[model samples]
Target: MSSGKYAFTKALKELRFHHCQTSPQSQAARSFLVRAYPTMKKHNPQTPILIREAQGIEPKVWARYGFGKERMESLAGLDEKAIESKVTEMATSEPQS
Candidate 1:
């Protein structure tokens, strides 16, 4: 198998592992699931077209799960600190449980 295919396979395995570990009630897990489930349902493509287009390789399972150059770049640019601060502010302002 090629390096790209190997990497894609590795990533898919890791995602599945992580997803299995996520708790339904945890805010972080719920947030991730909420975002991911819809995308998975809506797209339902066998392979990531984005990766295939960008890498000139056959689309792999990992790509179907949304790993690609566009996603990588967007993730790299994300300001985690800012996002955390916003989440913190919103949580604090909301009525307590």
Candidate 2:
């Protein structure tokens, strides 16, 4: 924030919305984000997103599981290297539908 390295941190920062467990809006948002960038939900949200020149790291977003407060998958962090690796993994892991 101080560096102005990140803009729209409010919209894109570590959002603690339990996408899988509640309101349609959040669910839709999470769905859209996942489809656009499927690995956004894999890391701990409290994890610091630090980077040297990847512009800015992606914020960790998380969702809660069913019922009472269990965590679900995250889109993971957004560093270039981490994103690359995650993309590779997702590519390999996809069922090719």
Candidate 3:
């Protein structure tokens, strides 16, 4: 599945997004979801994209890969574009395991 400059790789199993609904640190994550979620979901129907919201929690993006491997990235202090780039990198790259 392709979105913008990134394509979803087969190595990726799932994507988990963590953010606060109304916190400054989470703004970019929320923006990323708003702008990219639909396209990503439409293109990669088989992949699970989970969004978790909580109060005061740090914003983050997680990529789960095969063999129980996973990667996490902090989203704090980033802009929407940066968040998108980070997510794309995570989604397309192979897991270290």
RMSD of each: 17.6, 16.7, 1.8
lDDT of 1 by residue, 30-56 (tens): 343444444533443342322112222
Better of 1 and 2 by lDDT: 2
Best by lDDT: 3
Query: Order of all candidates by TM-score, from best down to worst?
Result: 3, 1, 2
* Prediction-by-prediction clash tally: 0, 11, 0
RMSD of 2: 16.7
Give the alpha carbon lDDT tens digit for every residue of 4-89 in model 2: 22121222222242233343333443444444332333332442332111222333334222233322233432444443343334
**What are the models' TM-scores?**
0.23, 0.21, 0.93
Model 3 scores worst on lDDT over the 10 consecutive residues at 1-10
lDDT comparison, 1 vs 3, better candidate = 3
Q: By TM-score, how accurate is candidate 2? A: 0.21
The sequence of per-residue lDDT tens digits that candidate 3 reaches over residues 16-65 is: 99999999889888987988888998888899999999999999989999
| C-alpha lDDT score of every prediction, in listed order | 0.27, 0.32, 0.88
